[model samples]
Target: MACIQVVIWLFVVQCSAVCFANYVLKEEPEYKHTLLKRILMEENFESLESKINNLTQRVEALEKENALLKHAPVAFLAELTKSVTSQNQIILFDSVKLNLGNAYFNVHGNFIAPVSGLYQFSVTACAATNHYIVLELIVNARVVGKVLTGDTGYNECSSNSFLVQLSTGDDVYVQHKTAGDYLLANPAAGFPTFSGVLLNVI
Candidate 1:
C-alpha cells in the first residue's frame, strides 16, 4: 500500500512542475514581444525627429534667399516733354545732375554693398537731339571710368554698361552735357513737357 501511495505522489509532483514551467514560458514570450515593440517605436520616433530638423533648415534658407532677391537692383525712370520757351530737360534724375551743353550727368547716391561678389551697372538715355550720352561710373565722388553711347540723335536711345567690385556705402551718379535751352522738369504726372534719364543697378 505504501509503495502505491509513493508512486501516486511522485506523479502528482511531476505534473505540477510541468504546469508551472508552461506558465512561465508563455509569460516570458509575451514580455519579449512587448520589449521588441517598444524598441521599434523608439527607432521610428528618432527618424521622424531627424526629418523635421532637415525641413526646418531648408525653410530658413529659402526665406533668406527670398529677402535678398527682393532688395537687389534698384531702378528709376524719367520722361521728357515739350515746353513753351525753353525745351524741357530732365536734369538731375537721381544722384547725377545733367548739363546739356557739357553732355554729362553728375551722379550721387548712397551705395550699400549687396554682397562680396562682382557687380554690374547699366544706364540708358533718350534724347531729341544728335549728341553723345556719356556714362561715368563714379565711386565716392570720383570718376572711375567713362563709357560713351557713340552716336545718339533726336528721338533716339543710347545705353552703356559697366562692371565693378563695390563695397558697402559707395555713391554713384551720371553727368550729361546740355545744349540749347534745356531745363530740368518735374517727373510727376501731368507736366506736359518732360525729359530725363533712367538709372538701373544690377
Candidate 2:
C-alpha cells in the first residue's frame, strides 16, 4: 500500500509540470506578437512625423519667395514726342513712347505706384521761346517740385529731379504751375521727358 501511494504522488507531480509548460509555450508567441505590433506602430508614427517636418519646410520656402516677388522694384520712363509748342492748363502726357515696369504711366499721364517705395522722379522741359520753363511735378494734385530753366531763349532745355517716398495709389504727373500757356513743344531735339523709378521698396 505504501509503495502504491508514492507512485501516484509522483505521477500527479509530472502531469502538473507538463500543463504549466504548455501554457508558457502558448503564451510566449502571443507576447511576442504584441511586442512586434507595438514596434510597427511606433515606426509608422515616426514616418508620419518626418513627412510633416518636410512639408513644413516647403511651406516656409514658398512664403519667402512670395515676399521677394512683392518687394521687387517698379519703374517707368516716358518721353513727349511732339515738337510743336502747345498751350495747356494741366498737361497729361498721353503718348507713352517708352514704358517699363508694367507701364505704370497711363493715358492720363499719372504714375501710380504698385508698391510703397522710395521713388526718384525727373522731368526735362524745353522752352520754345527760351525763358524760365515753368513745370510742376505734381503728386496727388499737389505741387511737390518744379522745374526752372536757367537760360532763356531759343532752343533752351532744363531738367529738374525730386526724390519722394510714395505709397500705392499716389498719383504723379506733370502740370504747368505758371500762368498762361506753358511751352512744352520740342519734338525734333527730344528734350521734353518725364520719368520715375522705384529706388527701394519699403
Q: What is the TM-score of each candidate against the true structure?
A: 0.35, 0.58
lDDT leader: 2
**In candidate 2, where is summed lDDT lowest over 10 consecutive residues?**
82-91
Model 1, 1-202: lDDT tens per residue?
A: 9999999999999999988767766879986687678877878787878999999999988876665555544333323332212332223444233322222223322233434334555555443344434444565666665544333334444556666665544554444433333222233432211122212222
lDDT, model 1, position 198: 19
Listed per model in order, the count of residue pairs whose N, CA or C atoms clash below 3 Å is 32, 3
Best candidate (score: TM-score)? 2
For each candidate in turn, give its C-alpha RMSD to the true structure in angstroms. Answer: 15.2, 14.4
| Span of 10 residues, lowest total lDDT, candidate 1 | 190-199
lDDT of 2 at 76: 73
TM match of model 2 to true structure: 0.58
